[model samples]
Target: MSKPFSQACENNKQPILDKLLVHFRQASRVLEIGSGTGQHAVFFAKNLPHLQWHCSDMPANHAGINQWLADYPSANLHAPVPFTIGQDSWPLELVVDKVDAVFSANTTHIMQRSEVPIMFDLIQKNLPEGGIFCQYGPFNVNGDYTSDSNRDFNQYLISQGCGGLWDIADLQVLVSGLDLLHQYALPANNKLLIWQKC
Candidate 1:
């Protein structure tokens, strides 16, 4: 089987890593919720050797993720972890022993609106006090789109029957248990939001 690839992942990995380095500088372990293609796993683990990067997703993506992990072979990077979303028990399954941070990119807007709250709930339950959750994706503020591209993207997502451009404020309301730390605007009109378990 050939390695799966995502051009967007390739483009965003470095910038994401730069932000992660600052926020998770002291973190020893991070659980990446949707490790699509394992590109971020390889790149981040190579760059931030101090933290253990655990890559996980639904079983279907495991093969591709494992292929990348096998090729990279970082002692600190663990990939091919299988997980189910919105199961309530799902996050606990992935949590296993210890996790200092949780990261998921480009997942929230693709999931159903109902599932977004569930994901937040699970992250809240799994992360210890003060643990950070880094979520990167396009988001709205007060029901307003930040860019024309994001507006179009939201429409496209709606056409596909998926939730799109979740409101950053709405997310804060959903995960009220978590404190919003930082919100960084990225190159592609996307945003990286950091929230800490309070």
Candidate 2:
């Protein structure tokens, strides 16, 4: 592909940046997980001059991300680092420097349910106290889907090998070390959840 594209990323990048601009203003380094297509990394890095943006994904997605980076090369934007949550020393091996913020968009429900906590474990190990982690996706509240669309989406995804939508309550229990700081309701019934390491 000349340059991978994501309509979802195109639609939501600005809104995500609106929050991260203020939220991560002080953050010097940001590690983006599941950087599908590397679209968000390029957009965010270009807009947010203060942060050094690091894009990461599985080896399968490296070329797409690298293509994006090469096309819109930024001094603060780094290339992809092999990342598979739960693998031993994967983060340390790929990420050479310390990171204060972790960002991932629309990835939780697409990954295996059992893999979610492992992802959190890796973030917890790397993100220091007071570090921020922002996740953008559709999620549930009180064990209930927020809308019929989300319910149908969850069912459709579960029918495949992908995980279903997650609930805030369950996530709080799963990653108790991180304190819920703010929850922003985004368009299309999606959400942007910000957590700070405790």
Candidate 3:
């Protein structure tokens, strides 16, 4: 089977990497949740050679993720372990030791809405003090969409029985042990939010 691809990933990888360079510079290992097509895993690992990028998604996605890794093959990029936010074990020790940073892109609106807070809870609980979590996706600000396209997209996701978009206000409560550090406005109406364990 051919490796999976995401055009969005191809387009935004570089811009995301630029910000990650600064936020994750001191991070030795990063756990990337919902690794989807594995494009970001390879790209980020190659660019940020200092970081050990470990990918995790549901079991069904592991094969496609491995395909990308085989083609690019970076020492810092490891195979994706099975991970379902509210189901599977955190896989923290399964992939690498000491996860100092966590990254997830375009996942907040894709997974079940109920699981969103769980994701935050796990990240904050597992990360050590000063550890960072960077999440990139289209998020609602104060329960409002930033643009018309995002509003339409949210409708589509709801029509398909997905979680639609997560409101920042709702998520703020879930980040108990984390403190908001930076929120960057990126292209395509997406925001890259960074938080640190406090």
lDDT of each: 0.86, 0.89, 0.91
What is the C-alpha lDDT profile of model 2 across 1-198, one tens digit per residue? 567789989999999999999889888999989999999999999999988999888888999999999889999999888887756454674356899999999989999988899988888778889999999999999989999999999999999979889998899999967889999999889999999999
Q: Which tens-of-lDDT digit does each residue in 85-153 have in candidate 3?
A: 889767957434979899999998998988888899889878889999999999999879999999999
Question: Candidates ranked by lDDT, best first?
Answer: 3, 2, 1
**Candidate 1 per-residue C-alpha lDDT over 111-196 given as tens digits, one digit per residue, 9 for 90 to 100:** 88888888888878778898999999899988899999899999999999988778888888778678998999987988999999
How many backbone clashes can be found in candidate 1?
0
Model 2, TM vs. native:
0.95
Global lDDT for candidate 1? 0.86
lDDT of residue 56 for candidate 1 = 86
Query: Which candidate wins on TM-score?
Result: 3
